[model samples]
Target chain A: MAKHVLRVVAVVYVLFLLVLPVALIVWRTFGDGLAPFAEALTSPSALHAFTVTLTVAGWAVLANTVFGVGAALLLVRHEFPGKRLLGAFIDLPMAVSPVVVGLALILVYGRFSPLGGLLESWGIQVIFSTPGMVLATVFVSLPLVVRAVVPVLEELGDEQEQAAHTLGASRLQSFVRITLPGIRWALGYGVVLCLARSLGEYGAVAVVSGRLVDQTQTLTLFVEERFQNFDQPAAFAAATALALIAVVTLLFTKLLRPKDRSDGN
Target chain B: MAIEVRDVNKSFGTTPVLHDVSLDVAAGSLTALLGPSGGGKSTLLRVIAGLERPDTGTVRISGVDATRLSPQRRNVGFVFQHYAAFKHLTVFRNVAFGLEIRKRPKDEIRKRVMELLELVHLEKLADRYPSQLSGGQRQRMALARALAVEPQVLLLDEPFGALDAQVRKELRTWLRRLHDEVHVTTVFVTHDQEEAIEVADTIVVLAGGEVVQAGSPGEVYDNPANPFVMRFLGPVTEIGGSLVRPHDIEISPDPVEGGSPAVVSRVVRLGFEVRVEVEIGGHEAWVQVTREQADRLGLGPGDTVHLRPAPGARSLVLAL
Candidate 1:
C-alpha cells in the first residue's frame, strides 16, 4: 500500500508538471476545426512575424558562431590577465533576465545616446527596429553557444595541432584541416542552441521590437498578441509551429551528440 | 643533416627546465636522449623540433640557422608518446596528410601512403581509424605518419612508453630495423636504459636538465660518466667508497694477488648467474659468478670469498 501511494504521488507530479501542460496546449490548438490553423499559416502578419523571427535568429546565430569559436579558442589555448573574469562575464547573460537585456540595448541605442545619434545622423535607425531585435537576441542568447563549446575546446589539447605543425602544415592549414574538424560537432550543437534560444526569446525582444505589427514582430510576439486579442486558435496554431521547429532541432541535436567510442571509428 | 644546439635555455615560469644545454647530433645516425623522468629530455626534443623555443641561444639544423623558424618551416617529424594520430582520419589518410598538405598529386599520395602502410605492415588495416587499432598497431601507424613526410630530422618523444612490455620489445627491434633502412638523423627520447642501448647509435644520458654523459652503449656500460649514470644504467653496489656493478666483480676462493678478502653476505640466483654479495671494508658489494665458479669456490650465503676490481673499468668519471 505504501509503494502504491509513492508511485501515485510521483506520477501525479509528472502529470501536473509535464503531461497536463502539453495536453492543454495541443487540445487548444486543435479545437478550431483546422481552419484557423490554415488561416494562421497563410496570413500576411503571421508570415511577416515568421520572417522577422528567422532573420533575427539566423543573424544572431551567425554572429555568435564566429565570436563564440574565437572566444573558445582564446580561452582554451592562450592565457592572459583576467581571463577567468572574461569567462565569467560571458556567463553573465545567462543569469540576467531577458527584459533587462532589452533595456540595456535601449539605453545604448536610444536616440539620445552618442552611438545612437551618430547612427541617426547617418539616417540609420537602430532602436525599435529589426536591428534592435537582433541586438536583443544576441544579448540574451550569447552565453548559450559559448557555454556549450568552451569545455570541449579546453579538453582538446594542442598536441594534434602541434603534430600537424611538425609535419610541415602551415598555421592556417592546421587550423582548417585539423582544429576545425575536431571542434565541429561542439560548434554545431552550440549553433543549434543559439538558434533555439533566440527563436523562443520574448521579454528582451518584446521591449526592443516595439510591437510593430508586420514590421519587427516575431513569432513569439505574434502568439502573445493573438492570445491577448482573444484569438486563441490563431495563437495556438502559431505556438504549434514553434513547437514543431523545436522538436526537429532537438532530434537533430540528438543525432549530432558525440557517438560512443566503439562505433565512432 | 647535423643538428647543433648551442647554449639553449628554457624555463616554465620560474622553474628552469633546460639549462644552457648543448649537444651535437651527426646526420644519418639514430641517437637516444636517455634520462630519468623530469630530466628535460622531452623538452630538448621539442626545442630541436621547433615545437618549443628556447629562452636563449640557437638551434641549427643541417648547418642552417633555424632558431627562429616555426616547426612547420623546420621540416621535422615528431611521434608523440600517445601516438597523437588524427583520430578522425583513416590510417591511410593520416599517412597521406603531410603529403596532402604539400599539395601532392592524388595518385602520388595514394601510392606513397600505401608504401608507408606496407612499411609498417599495416596495409591491410589502412582503412581503419586509429581508435579501431590495437595499441601496438596505433604506434606503428604513428610511425608511418611521421615517416610519410620524409622529414629531414625525426624526433620521437617516448614513442614506445605507452605500449605493453611484449609489444614494446617487438616494436623496439622493428624500430631498429626501420631506422637502419631510413638512415635519417633521428633522436628518440627514452628513460629506459635497455631500450636506448638496444636501439641508439649514441646514447646521451641526461640528468637534472643537463647532459651527464654521451657515448656508445657498451662504452657507457663499461665506464659510466659518474655515479648517477652507473646507478641509472645498471644494478650498483657500493664498496670501499666506490660503486661497482655486480657483473663486473670477480670472485675467487683462494686468496689472490691484488684482491680483497670478504665474507659472503648472500647469494641470489639471477637465472643467468648467481649474484654474490660480499662485505668488504665495511661496505657491501655484489659480484656475479657462473654456476661453475660458485661450485668451484664452494660459496654460499655465510662464507668467505676474495674480490678484485676488474681492469679497464671506470671508462668515464663524472663530476660528483
Candidate 2:
C-alpha cells in the first residue's frame, strides 16, 4: 500500500516537473500551425545557434572521452603519489556550480591574465569566443565520462590484461585488443552522458560566450533570448529540438548499458 | 622449458608476501605449489611467469634470464583462477587471439584455433561467447587460449578453485591427461593437498612465504622434512618425539598388553573409512579404521579403547 502511494507520488512529480514542461513546449511550438514552426526552425539565427551548440558539444565530448578513459585507467591500474588527489579533482566539475566553472575559466583565460593576453595578442581568442564556449562545456561535462568509466575499469581487474601480457601481447596490443574491448560499453555510455550534459549546459557557456547575437549564442542561450523578446513560438521550437536530442541520447544510453551476463543461456 | 627462480623476494607496500624463495622446475614436468592462502604460492608462480616482479631475484626460463624481462617477452602462459576469457570474443576468436597478434597466417591461425577447440572439447561451441559457457567449459577455454601461443612454460593460479567439487575432480583428471599429452613445463598453485598429490609430478610446499619443502608426492607424504610440512600434508598428531599420521594409529576395544589405555572421544564415519578420536596420555590422537573394523569393535564416543602405533608405520622424529 505504501509502495503504491510512493509510486503515485513519484509519477505525479515526474509528470509535473518533466513531462508537462516538455509537452507544453511541443504543443506551443505547433499550436498555431506547421508554417510558424517551419519559419522558426529555418531562421538564420536559430540555424546558427544549433551549429554553434553542436560544434562546441562535439569537440567537448571527444576531448572528455579521451581524458576520461586515460584518467580511469590510471586510477584503476596504477599506484602513484597523489592518485587520491587526482580522483578528487575529477569530481570537481560535478560538485561546483556550472556558473562557478564559467567564472573560473574566465579568470584563467581573461584578457588581464598573462596566458589569456598572450593568446589574444597571437590572434587566438579564447574568452568571449567559440573556444571559450567549448572550454565551458568541457568543464561542465568532464566528470560524466570519468565517473561512468571508472567503476567498470575497476570492476574488470587486471587479470585479463595480465593474461594478454603473459600470452605474449605487448602493452599497446593488450590495451587495444583486451582492455579497450572490455570497457567499450562503459566508454560509450560515458560519451552519451557527456553529449547530453554538454548539449543542455547553460550557465557556464552563457558566462563565457558573452551572448554574441548569432555567433557565440548556443541553442540554450537562443531559447532564453527568444523568450525574453516575447517570441514564445521561436523559443518553444528551439527548446523542443533540444528536448528531442536529450530524448535520443537517453535512448542511446539505455541501449549501450551493459547486459547482465549472469542469466545463463 | 625448465624454469628457475633464485632468492626471489616480493613485498606489497610494507608487508612482505614472498621471502627468499628459490625453486627449479624441470623441463616438461608438472609441478604444484601447494600451500594455504596467503602462503605466497600464487605470488611465486607469478614471479616465475614474470607477471609479478620480485624485489631482489633472478628468474630464468630455459636458461634465459627473465628477471628483468616483461611478461610479454617471457613467453609464459598464465591461467587465472577466474578463467579470464575475453567476454566479447567468441571461443574460436579468443583461442586465435595470441596467434593473430603474433601475425601468423590466417589459415594457420584458423587451423590452430580449431585444433585447440577440439582439444579442449569445445568445438561444438566454438562460436559461443564466454558468458554462454559453464564454469568448467570456461576454464577449458582459458586453457586452450593459453596453449594457443605454445608458451615455453605454463603457470596456472588455482585453476580449479572456483568450480564445484564434482567438476573440480573431473577437470583435475582432464588437466593431468592434457599435461601428459603436451609435455610442456607446467606449474600450478593449489591449496588442496589431494590435488597436489594426485596431479603433480613434483610438489613444492610453502608456508609463510617460504618454501618449506619440495619433493615427489610420495616422498613428501612419507618423509616430511619439518613439522609444518607434516601438518600441511595431512592431519598429524605429535606423540612424544615423533609425528604420527591418523592412518598409522591402530584402535581396538580390547586392552592390548603393550597398547596405551585411552577413551574413544569421537567417532566419525567417512564413507569407506571411519575416523575415531582417542584420548591417550593426556592428548587427543586420531585413528583411521576400516568400516568393518569399526563395526566389529562397535565403538562410540566415551567408550574405552586401546591405541597403538602400527608396526612399520612411517613416523618422523621431531627435531626439537
Candidate 3:
C-alpha cells in the first residue's frame, strides 16, 4: 500500500513537472500532420543551426574527451602537489553556471581585452565566433567525461600495467593494449554523455554566439529565436528534436554503462 | 639467470623499507624471501626485478648491473599476489600478450600460449575472461602469462597469498613441480614459513628491513643466527634468557645433571604430541614429548620438574 502510494506520487510528480510539458510540445509538433514539422526542420536557417550545433559539439567533445582521459589518469594514477585543487577545478564547470562561463570567456577574449586585441590583430577572431561558441560548449560539458572515467580508473589500480611492463611492453603499448581496453566501456559512456551535454548546451552558446541567423546560431538558440518570432511550429519542432536526441542519448548511456559493478567487469 | 644484490638500500619517503640488504640467488635455483608483513621482502623482490630502484648499491642480473634499468628492459616476469589478470581479455590473449608485443609470428605465439595454458592446466578455460575463472585458476593463468615472456628471472610476490589454505597448498606443490621442469631462476616472496620451507631451496628470512638469516631451509631452521630468526622460523620459548624451539627441550620430574630447576605449569595435549609448559626463574618455556612419555611422567600443574636440552638436539643454549 505504501509502495503503491509512493509509485503514484512519483508518477503524478513526473506527469506534472516533466511528462505533461514534453507531451504538450510533442503534440503541438505533430498537430499539423507532420508537414510543418518536416518543413521547419529543413529550412535553410534551421539546417544551418543543425550544422553549427553538430560542429561545436564535435569539437567540444573531442577536446574534452582527450583532456578528460588525461586528467582522470593523472588524478587517479599519480600523486603531486595541488592535486586536489586540480580535481576541484575540473568539476568547476559543473558547479558554475554556463552563462558565467560564457561571460568569463568574453571578458578574456572580447576584442577589447589585451589578449583579445592581440589575437584580433593576428587576424583571429575568438569572441562572437565559432571558436568562442565551441569554448563555451566545452566548458559547460567539461566534467562529464572526467567524472565518468575517474571512478573506473580508480577501481583499476596499476597492478596490471606494472605486470605489462614486466612482460616487456613499453608504456605506450601497455596503455593501448591493456589500460585503454580496460577502461573502454567507461570511456565510451563518458564520451556519449559529453556529446549529449554539448549538443544541448544553450545559455553559454547564446551569449558567445551573438545569435546571428545562419552564422553562429545553434539548434538551441534557433528554437528561442523562432519562438520569439511567432514561429511556434518551427520552435516546437526543434524542441521536440532536442528531446528526441536526449532520449536517444539516455538509451545509449544505459546500454554502454554497466548497470552496476557486479560480475567484476 | 643468477641474481646478485650487493649492499642495496631502499626507503619509501623517509620510512626505510629495506636497509642495506644483500643476497644471492643461484642460477636456476628457487629462492624464497620469507618474512612477516612490512618486512621489505616484496620491496626487495621489486628491486631485483627492476620494478624499484635501490637508493644505494647494485643489483646484477646475469652479471649485468640492473639497478638503473627500466622494468620493461629487465626481462623479469612479475606475478602479483592478486593474480593481476587482464580482465577484458580472454586467457589465450592474456598468455599471448608478451609474444605479441615481441612480434613473434602468429603461429609461434599460438603454439607457445597453448603450450603454457596446457602446462598450467587452463587450456579448457582459455577463451573465458579472467573474471570468470576461480582465484586459483586466475593465478595459474597469471603464472602462464608470466612464463609466456620467457623472462630471464621469474618473480612472484606472494603468488598464493590471496587464496585459501587448500588452494595455497596445491599451488605450492604445483609451483615446485613447475620450477623443477622449467629450471628457471625464480624468486618468490611469501610470509608463510611452511611454504618457504617446503618449496624454496633457499630461504632468506627478513625482519625490520634486514636479512635476519639466509641459508638452506634446514640450516636456517636447525641453527638460526638470532632470536628473531629462530622465532620467525618456528615457535620459540624464552628460557634462561635464550630462545629455543618447543621440541628442543625436555622436561624431567627430578633434577638431573646440567638440568635447570622448573615447575610444571600446564600439560597441553596437542593431537598425538604432548606439550609441557614449565616455569624456570619466572620465565615460561615449552617442552615437547611423546604421548607415552608424557603419560609415564604423569606431570601436572604445580608439579616440580627440571628442564634440559633433548638428547642430540642442538638447542640455542646461550642461556636456555
Candidate 4:
C-alpha cells in the first residue's frame, strides 16, 4: 500500500510539474485559432530568430563534436602532467552558471579587451554578433559530449587498436576501421546531447546576443521579448514550437541510439 | 621469420617489467614463453611483435633490424588474450579488415575471408556479429583475423587463457594442428605448464623478469637446470641433497634393505594415477603410483611403507 501511494505521488508530481505546463502552453498556443500562431511564425523577425538559433546550434554542435571526441580520447588514452586539471576544466562549464559563463566570455572577447580591440581594429566584430552567440552556446554545451564519451573510451581499452596495428593497419586506418566503429554509439549519443544542449541554451546566449531584434535574437529570447511586449499569444506560440522541437529530438534520439546492452557484447 | 631478441629491457615508470631478456626463435618453430603472472612473458611477446618498444634492446626479424619499426611496418600477427574482435562487424568483415585496409580487390578479399572462415570452421556464421559467438568461437575468429594478414611472425598473448577448461584443451590441440599446417614462426605466452609442454617445440621459462631456462619440453622435464624449473614443471621432492620428481619415487608395502621406511600420510586418487604422500626421514614426500599398483600395494593413510628412488631416476643438485 505504501509503495502504491508513493508511485501515485511520483506520477502526480510529474504531471503537475511537466505535463500540465506543456499542455497549457499547447492549448494557449492554438486556443484562439491557428491564424495568430501562423502569423507569429511567418513574421520576418520570428523567422530570423529561429534561423539564428539553428545556425548557432549547428556550429556549436560541430565544434563540440570535434573538440569533445579529441578531449575524451586524450583523457582516456594518454597520461600527462596536469591531466586531472584538464579533466576538471572540461567540467567547469557544467558547474558554473551559464550566465557567469557568458560574462566570462564577454570579459575575454569584449571590445575593450586586448584581443577584442585588436580584432576590431582589423574590422572584425565578435561581441554582440552571431559569433558571440556561438561562442556562448559552445561554452555551455562543451561538457555534454566529453562527459558522455570519456566513459565509453575508458571501457574500450587499447587492445583492439593494438591488434589492428599488429595486423598491418596504420594508425589512422586502425582508428577509422576499429576504434571509431567500436565507439560509434557513444559518439552518436554525445552528438545528440550536444545538439540538444545547444538548441535550448538561453542564459548564456541571451547575455551575449545583446537582444538585438532580427539580428542576434534566438527563439528563447524572442519568446521573452514577445511576453514582455504583452504579446501573450506570440510568446506561447514560440514556446510551443521550441517545445515541439525538443520533444521531436528526444524521441528521435531514443529511437535511433544503440540499445544499452548490459553485457557490452 | 626467425626472431632474434637481443638484451631486451623495459621498465614502467620506476619498476622494471622486463630485464635483459634475450631469445631466439627459429623459423617454422612454435615457442612457448611459460611463466607465472607478471613474469614479463607478455611484455617479451609484445616486444617481439613490435607492440611494445624495449627501453634498450635490438629486435631482428628475418635478419633485418626491426627495432625502430612500428607494429604496422613489422608485419606480425598478434592475438590478444581476450579475443579483441571488432564487435560491430560480422565475422566475415572482421577477418577481412586487414585485407580491406591494404586495398585488396573486393572479390579477392571476399575469397580470402571465406577461405579463412572455412579454415576456422565458421563458414555458416559468416554474417553473424562477434557478440553472437561463444567464447571459443570468438577466439577462433580472432585467430583467423590475425592470420588474414599473412604476417611473418605470429605472436599470441595467452590466447587460451580466457576459456573454460574443456574449451582450452580442445583449442590447445587445435592450435597445435594449426601450427603444424601453417608452420609460421609462432611465439605464444602461457602460464600453464601442461599447455606449454603439449604445444611448444621449445619452452622458455621466465620468472621474476628473467629467463630461468629454455629447452625442449622433454629435456626441461627430465633434466631441469635448477630447483625453480624443476618445481615449476611439476611436483618436486628434495631427498638428501638432490631434487626428485614425484613419479620417480617408488613405494612398496614390504621394507627393502637400504630403502627408507616411512608412514603413508595421505592418498589422493587421480584418474590414472594415485598420489600418495609419505613421511620419509622426518619430511613429507610425494609418490605417484598407478591405480593398479596402488590397489595391489593396499597403501592408505597411516600405513607403514617403504619408499625408494627408482633406479636410473633423474635427480638434480643445484646450488641455489
Instruction: Tell me the tens digit of each residue's lDDT in model 4 across A119-235.
Output: 889987888998889999999899888887888888888898998898788888988888787777778878887888898899999888899998999999999999999989889
Per-model TM values vs. the true structure: 0.95, 0.94, 0.97, 0.97
lDDT of 2 by residue, B1-320 (tens): 39988999999889899999999999999999999999999999988888889999899999999999999898888899999988878999889988988999999999999999999999999999898899999999999999999999989999999999999999999999999999989999999999999999999999899999999999999889887888889888755457889788777778875678888899999999998887877877778889999999999889988876788777788787
C-alpha lDDT (0 to 100) for residue A213 of candidate 2: 83
Please give me the total number of clashing residue pairs in predicted model 3. 0
TM-score of chain A of each: 0.93, 0.95, 0.97, 0.95
- Candidate 1: Cα lDDT at A229: 94
Q: What is the CAPRI rating of model 2's predicted complex? A: medium
Model 4 CA deviation exceeding 4 Å by range: A256-258, A262-265, B253-258, B318-320
Q: Residue-wise lDDT of candidate 3 within A24-137, one digit each (tens)? A: 999999998888999999999999999999999999999999999999999998899999999999989988999999999999999999998999999999888999999999
Q: Score the docking of each candidate (DockQ).
A: 0.70, 0.58, 0.69, 0.64
Q: Which consecutive 10 residues in model 3 chain B have the weakest lDDT in total?
A: B311-320
Candidate 1 per-residue lDDT over residues B209-269, each given as its tens digit: 8998989898787778788898888777765456777666767787977778899988887
Candidate achieving higher lDDT, 1 or 3: 3
lDDT, residue B34, model 3: 97
* Residue pairs of candidate 2 with colliding backbone atoms: none
Clashes of each: 2, 0, 0, 0
How high is the DockQ of candidate 3? Answer: 0.69
